[model samples]
Target: MPRSILSWSDRSLAAQFALAGGVVMVLSMLLIGRVVAARIEESVVRNSALATSQYMDSIISPLSQDIAEADTLPPGARRALDEIFTNTPLGERVASFKLWKPGGLVVEATDKTIVGRRFEVTDSLARAFAGEVRAEFQNLSDEEDRGEHALGLPLLEIYSPVREVWSGEVIGVAEFYEVATGLERDLAEATRNSWISVALVFVAIGGVLFLIVLRGSRTIDRQRAALTRQLGELEALSTRNTALRERVQQAAARASAANDRALRRIGADLHDGPAQLLSFAALRLDALRGQLAETGEIDAVERAVKDAIREVRGISKGLGHPDIEDRGPCEIVTGVAETHEARTGTKVAVICDLPEGLALSQAEKLCLYRFAQEGLNNAWRYGGGRGQEIRLDCRDGRLGLWVRDAGPGFPPEDAERHEAEDYSGIGLAGLRDRVESLGGSLTAGNRADGAGAEIGMELDLRGA
Candidate 1:
């Protein structure tokens, strides 16, 4: 019930059982010992009383015969009782004696002052009148027992019935008190032995149970300690793995940014060197067309050079990412969509619902730019540029982008096939990897309406 006791109990199963079982064993031993001691004393007292009553009846029954016909004993019977007390060997053992008639009248007594005095009828007196004997040891609370109380000796009080000689009818009661110092000593020894035996048995049983519980408690404690150590090791390993994962993510992001910068540099090189050379060759062919005799060949050569220049410029444009470091998410998305529309000559619907002040890292912005570029390019190529839409918004602390087109969606096998194949181009697989590097996800599938294909990406802005 107290905090300290609760803590002790929590220490182990054996300690708890010891505390509870010890209390139960002690109480059980005490109860059993008390009952056994009481029964032993009662048995000893009753046997002694029965033997004394039988002997006393042989001597006093004839002397008390006058009580069957009269309430008072005659003088001769009274003198016989007095001589038995004064001169007989039985007098040395017995402390007091009485003869009674019906209605609680004491016809004769060793204490002569009580002769012919009436008292309340007790249960023992009633049972004796009905032909039963009753006895008690050292119980001197009765009014008639005052003299015996003063004697201060352990006494056995007995009530025995007196019978009429001719009719064998119980007509009166004889009550006596016998000294019981020997019986009291025997009872005291027996009680002590009984208590000791009960206590020993209880202790033995409790010890056996406690030993069994202690064995089990020790096993459990060992197992618990082992489990605790294992759990601590697992926690340490988990912390190390988490730190490694963060490092990997940061490396991926940095690599993506560096790759974007490299592509931008390549784009500038193509536009400035090869593209300019192809444009100058096409101009020289146009000027030399008028002087050539075969104008058809000259015109065809000029057209091929101009077409190569256009292809190189397109490759350069596609390789470069727009400047988006200074822009918010909404502006970046809108700028990419507008650029896609301008280059492809296809109408792309743009919807921006991004929150105010939405911030993004440089790597994240590059990823977003590439995502929009690839998504719209796929829509225009596969969907014939019909119903192309780019949706961007921030919801529930996450930033999301979706590009949808009214076209037959990707087949189920397309995703599996893409994963198994290797490609150097910037495609959906590449975009997926870039998104994942920044702790985002990309999914390309059919729209829920079943009328179009959709490419969606979601980024948790909390980390950003």
Candidate 2:
């Protein structure tokens, strides 16, 4: 009927340990009590048998002589037996007695009617005839033992062998029934005392162990709570790191967009302010030359003003980007390549192998345009102004731009040094930043043929 310890809901470690310890302690105590009681009973029975056998042997020698031949003992021996049995220290403790011959015949007894009766040889009687003394606490419930049963009390039955003095042969068996009230009371008390002592020892040991377990349980609980708190903190920190990374990406995109806007503004300013003013100055110089017809200084000034106007206009045109938001990938690439070819007056081979109507965001389009523009310019200035190849392709969910020129490639060491110095001139580094801000990657190296410099940019367009 006991509940299982594991079945307990939300039970603490200390409680579980106590429950298990208590169960083991109780089981151990039960086994100890059984063993102690058995040993006590054995000792008590041996002592009782030895005492009863000695007292009966001394007084029953005469009765045994006449027991087999006669139904009753001789009167003289009978009177002596009667006097000893009723009026002695042995008689006070012994409740009843019986004498048996070899064939289960009751030859003489304290109960007169049973003197001539024959009963079956019991296990105890058989053992006695075989020269053994047997003693046990018995209930006296057998039919042959009805006389003793009538006493209505517990008895210690001792079966003693009556042997011949000279031959050392067992002649008859004597059954002695002793009142067991005092013995039972003593045994019960001893058992109670033993159980109490053992239980106290077990409980004391269990108590000490439980206290140690309880203390350890408290420490474990505290550690568990602390670890849970630390785990929560780590999760929160991870979430914050993710948010911070997202914010950094957003900021980089905004910065790239700001740079493009500034370039357009600077280009507009150059064209509207500096280029217009220079053109007006060139026109006035021409007019002064017309008025001072043969002045050589006037002619040099007019030509200088005209050259300045052209240079300023070229600078403005180079800085501005064509609006290409509504255009697809091919149109955007073609526009950038053509503008570069026109301004530099160099041959640029354009190759476009993209899916029809490839959609790109406005920022992504600007990034590609800037990449192509910078790459071609670098190729012209540093790549011997030779054959240049501009390629735009979208395949396998990626958009790519590759620019190559048949010129000496940029050395890896030189590239590393430039990057460390944060080089931005000629717009190679700036182009890389704009592409990267749009979640793209750019690489510059020699072409696979090892004959020319190459700049390549790739963007993941799966999200788009």
Best-fitting candidate, measured by TM-score?
1
Clashing pairs in 2: none
Off by over 4 Å in 1: 1-3, 6-13, 65-69, 100-103, 127-131, 163-170, 249-464
After best superposition, candidate 1 residue 221: deviation in angstroms? Answer: 4.1
The sequence of per-residue lDDT tens digits that candidate 1 reaches over residues 1-464 is 99997898677889889998899888988899999999998888888878988888888899888888788888898888888988668888888998888899999999989988999998889999999888988788989889989999989899988988889899888899888889889999999999989988998999999999999999999998999999999999988987787788789988877777787788789899999999889888888987878899888888888888888888888888667879887777788889878977989888989767777888878877888878888787777788899999889988899989997767666732222111114788778888898788988887888777888899888865
lDDT of 2 by residue, 225-291 (tens): 9999999999999899867765776688888788767867887898899889988887788777768
TM-score for every candidate vs. truth? 0.62, 0.52
Residue 125, model 1, lDDT? 91
Predicted structure with the largest lDDT when compared to the true one: 1
